[model samples]
Structure formats: C-alpha cells, structure tokens
Target: MNRKCDKKCLELSFPAVEAEASKGIATLSARLTQNGLPEHKTDDVKIALAEAINNVVEHAYSGIASANVQVNCRLCKERLEIVISDSGAPLPGLRIPDGKPAQLGSSIQNLPEGGFGWFLIHQLTSEIRYERYDGNNHLCLRFDL
Candidate 1:
C-alpha cells in the first residue's frame, strides 16, 4: 500500500456469502470516505465492490460453508482499484457477455440470485478485469474519480 496514494487493505473471513459481500462493500465505502472521496462516487464504489465480492462468494463457494474470499483495495490519485480473489473453483475463461439479460437460476448461475450483480458492477465501475490463475479466480474493478 502506498502512503501517498492513501491505499488501504483489509482481509476478512465470513461463513455466509452474503454477509461477506456486504461487509466487503461496507469496508470499501468507509475507506473511500476516510480517504476524502467525493460523496457522488461513494455509491458507485460501494456497488462495484459488492458485486465483485459477491461473485466470488456465491459463484465460487456455491452454498459451501468453507470458502475464503480475499479483498484488496488500493487508492491511487484519481482512482480506486479493488481486487477480489478466491480459491474455491476455476472460472471459465470468457468475458462476461454483454447486451443480454442475466439469467439467475441455472447451472451457469451458481447462486440463482447473483446475476444482477455483474450488471450493476458494469453500470457503476469505470473498468472491470478478470483473471484465473493456478486454481485461483481474480476479479479486479476500478472506479475513476
């Protein structure tokens, strides 16, 4: 973490997926506030962070009790970047498709309720990136100030 950048990082473990996601979002919002981010961008940052965290919790764990989701947040000048990583399962190597209504309840949709997460993420964030490496799934989102 860069001191000049006001970068802050947090690591939390939660048994409930929703709880984990919500907690991660709350933490991000608080960090932004403490770092003097404008009020207008707070909601956008919160939503994007929640989506990234929920995707890992719901899709990777799939109702399992034992799962770990790691959230990393870095604030640089006019940008905030959040990187969420999980080790539960390998993700498909395809970008999230565009221009289609997200279907929530299918084998393709693990939680049956997280389809809207990605949609909201796209609407709120400036950039979204995904990567899978050595059995770890990583999703990174950035919000420009």
Candidate 2:
C-alpha cells in the first residue's frame, strides 16, 4: 500500500542526448539515495529513467542535433513519481507492451538485438504512462517506495 504526504519535487532540464541522459540518471540516483531510498529501489528508478531519456534521444530527436529533455521528480513518503518530457517528435502511435518480463531464449544466437528498453521500464516501475501535449512528449513513471 502506498500513501502520499508532503511532496518534495525536483526538476532537471538538460540536453536530449546520450551523454546528458547518463548524467541525469546519475544525478537522480544520487538524490534518491541521499533521501534514504533503498539501493535496489534507487537502481530500479535509475534504469527506468535511463531508458525513458534514451528513448527520447534516440527515437524522438534522432535527426535533430540538440534539444532539451525535462525531468520532474516528485517524492512522497510512500511513492515517487517521475515525469520526463521533451519537445521532439511525438511517437505516431506509442504502444507500450503488456506488463510482462521479456523471455530469454536458450542460446545467445536467439538474443534480442534491440527493443528491450520499454520492457525493462515497465517491469521496474509500478505505473507507466505517456502523453503528447503542446508539442512535447511526456512519459510518466511511478514507483511505490
């Protein structure tokens, strides 16, 4: 069960690129850890946030040289909510997979080459939501703390 208390929110804006994404994840992970979040839970948040930011950098702003990605994190006593937004091309028809873990095959040859990011995001987070508003793509992820 989750309960909400007074919220402490942090907002970060950075370049929508692979390097910035890594830095954002590191900053977020550190903040969460400093606030007394468990190590495993913090790691889960970091991984999910990395995937979200990377999706924006790779797919949303592929041709663009530079753009901005905004991350807003709201922390409460029992839950943490993160919203990542970017002013890039919105997904035509973004369809997240059903919340199921990706199946691993028996051999290395059967390994997936790509398309595992969303699966991991969904698996790690308690809730995942996406929207496009006012020319910006917003992806929201929630975790029960």
Candidate RMSDs in order: 5.3, 2.9
| Candidate 2 local lDDT, 8-108, one digit each (tens) | 67789999878888898899888877866766688799888888888888988988666899998888877888889898987767655564545777899
Over the stretch 55-125, how does candidate 1's per-residue lDDT look in tens digits? 66666777555467777777776887777778765555445535244665556646554357667888888
Q: What's each prediction's TM-score?
A: 0.74, 0.85
Global lDDT of model 1: 0.68
Whole-model Cα lDDT of every candidate shown, in order? 0.68, 0.81
lDDT of 2 at 110: 86
Per-candidate total of colliding backbone pairs: 0, 0
Runs in model 1 lying further than 4 Å from the true structure: 1-16, 63-65, 102-114
Best by TM-score: 2
